[model samples]
Target: MKLIFEKSVPGRCCALLPACDVPVRPLESRFARKDPPRLPELSEVDLSRHYTALAGRVHGVNDGFYPLGSCTMKYNPALHEELAALPGFAGVHPLQPQHTVQGCLEVLARAEALLCEVTGMEQMTFQPAAGAHGELTGLLLIKAYHRDRGDAARTKIIVPDSAHGTNPASASMAGFEVVNIPSAPDGCVDLEALRAAVGPDTAGLMLTNPNTLGLFDRNILQITRIVHEAGGLNYYDGANLNAVMGVARPGDMGFDVVHLNLHKTFSTPHGGGGPGSGAVGAGALLAPFLPAPRAAAAGGGYAFETPPKSIGTVKAFYGNFLVVVRALAYILTLGGDGLSEASENAVLNANYLKALLAPYAPPACAGVCMHEFVVTLERLKKETGVTALDVAKAMLDCGIHPPTMYFPLIVHEALMFEPTETESKETLDWAAAQITGILRRAAEDPQSLHAAPCTTPVGRPDEVAAARAPKLRYRFDTL
Candidate 1:
């Protein structure tokens, strides 16, 4: 396929506009650029075709199965999208008067209430824009709460080795020193290691229940108790909340602060970088320190309030508002019972896929998993010199988006798969068969796997080069 710029033809345009009706204002010399900007010139038909081709190249949940683990690449219902796109919700600006945007405010308030019920948190702020941002916001709340109590020496955040990388990054961003705790052989947090890590300097623990390895920690309550006993707050990274949505609540697990990935767990369109709603929820202790201008109940209506001891505004206006609308739509559409069923189906799909693929790529942990699970290609790699990357690339040839590769850091040649609730048994079976076939091919002819993904428009990107020196946009010289 040629770049759109390569297909550009001189003096070609879609439509000729009428003469300007308004008087034109000349720009000051200081405000004007020395050279006219260069852009691709193409006829309407050519431009449309070019973009249509590019769109086809972009694979999304709508395109096919996406089992990217820990990301919850599930199929969000289009109904939520339709509801979010309604003019009253989508057209309103944040700067609109409070009374005028009452409907928007009410929607936000209702969404917060539903999320609170699901997570068992007292108060929530839809400020932080993504899960990591939520993590940072939650940590800041912990920091403020501890400092307010004069426990200023508490500056360390304990994170398990099996946690999302964002866990430590968010902690560090919040100016807290991160203490790394190892995972036990069973892939849950090592309780003894956690115990050893906490002390006077410990501020909190940022944990992802049903962590990156996708195993729910049986010791979650005891884990939170240890932190609370040490005067450290517990922060729950609700990335894996899909596995336990209505099944359990983070607050019940004793977490002081929780951050939910509304985009992932809730039915919001995320990925390709966001427009995600992190939406931090807090237990009573951390509520006072939540980000400012939170939606609150006022008489029979909803109003925004900055908590007396707020950490100030974390975002301009509220969060990604439309994302909130979509999430809220999902909650209302599913209701309580449907939400629980979604969780159950998500867990069931994951376990079923894990069982099917066990022979080709054994899981990183024993026993059943929750919504997602990790499988390592250690044996396949040793026997066939086909690393996890090769298997992933081969999946592309099979018209399947690959599982997350080399993640959770702990698993060797990891391929984390999360066949979320939206996937059917037929889809799971096809994915399993594809993996099994790929592994067989890997063993029989490793070289072909190494050169896999011949089916895609571009094969075998120079990943290291692309990362270090990316050609992000088109340049005339590149042609």
Candidate 2:
């Protein structure tokens, strides 16, 4: 469990250099650094074992149940990775000529078309690098569309209290004043509140259908209609689209803009700070304002085209190419029916797991949940001093990654769980059992739950102190 640098041996070095194939050029004086960086020195075997041990400590979908709630931690197919690793997709340089990268362009074009068909959008741009990035891109599109028509007065965006934290942040980042609305008694948008909130300055309403509460709003159409009727637009947050995928279309629901999390609904998840794609899709209303150089069908082959009044480049180039490659392969492999089935299974898994845990910890809302559910330990905390954080820490000892803790900010002591379609019934059963055991421990020995997770290499950390005074590196006095 030592740090990589701690294991460094001064005399050791990895055998990496090959004999000079040609002439070796020395660096000029101005271009060279006076002292070399202090990097770990180790033999090949030493480096291999260090990383292998680190890998073993990590938890992922392949390791065990990963019901991460709003973040759908579904299992990706091996085939998607294989396809992305192909030479034509992986080897092509971003600056390659149009004719030379036909196959790559085709991947973009085909994915755009299929995704548009799924979301009921007219066009898409793989420019945004992540979901929040896509949210900004989509917001810019809405802002441009309104400004183009001399409707500069529309400078506000409405967001529900149950929305992802990024929704209001994205709106604010896009220079729109965010108007917050409260959720109704049933965890859906409060219609009356939304009705009163829209006005001359209303740019749009940013919402996630089957929202962060894990409930589909039956009033979605009416909600979107209200924004359109008010001379504003509706922006769909596709972070939770896995709950409805082929079951419904956001465009048909009257939304004009949507930012899809390719990592969430699509197979190429960018967990742990991975490279990701958050392709934005728009209806005809905002299509012309989309980011530039999207794959377009050009005569016999494909070509890149910028929209008439494009918002310009969002990223340096077309989004994480390998991520897009993996996503396209996932969609093609699943097809229409398979995608629909995947959504259905996702819903089923969530509901099934919710039922098992309902006896121990009541859910935040009543009735059916879509692809995820939130359970509150408020009552347990009040009765036994065992908060959601204690229960989550207890889960680590059970060898399970705990559900999202204290999220959505609506419910007190909230723990959200999303057992995606990829999980089996047995896995769900075991996770429920582990959680139930934790609940029993909370009731029987409240003090013990406070010091839970006794088995991990590292125990609970002082997160607030760590954030404020972070120990950023190893203490090497004389490197």
Winner by TM-score:
2
lDDT of 2 by residue, 1-479 (tens): 88899999888997788989999898798999988888989999998999899988888777888788888889977787888889988899988999999998999999999999999999999989999999999999999999999998999999998888899999999999999999985569999999999998999999999888899999999999999999999999998999998999999999998988888899785557667788999999999999988899999999998899999998897988788888988998899998999999999999999999999999999999999999999999999999999999999888888899998788999999998999999998988998998898888999889998799878888899989988788879945
Q: How many Å off is the CA of 352 in candidate 1?
A: 0.6
Task: Return the number of clashes found in candidate 1.
Answer: 0
Q: What is the C-alpha lDDT of each candidate?
A: 0.91, 0.91
Give candidate 2 regions above 4 Å deviation: 19-22
The per-candidate count of clashes, in order, stands at 0, 1
Task: Tell me how far candidate 2 lies from the true structure as C-alpha RMSD in angstroms.
Answer: 1.5
Reference-based TM-score of each model: 0.96, 0.97
Model 1: runs farther than 4 Å from truth?
9-22, 468-470
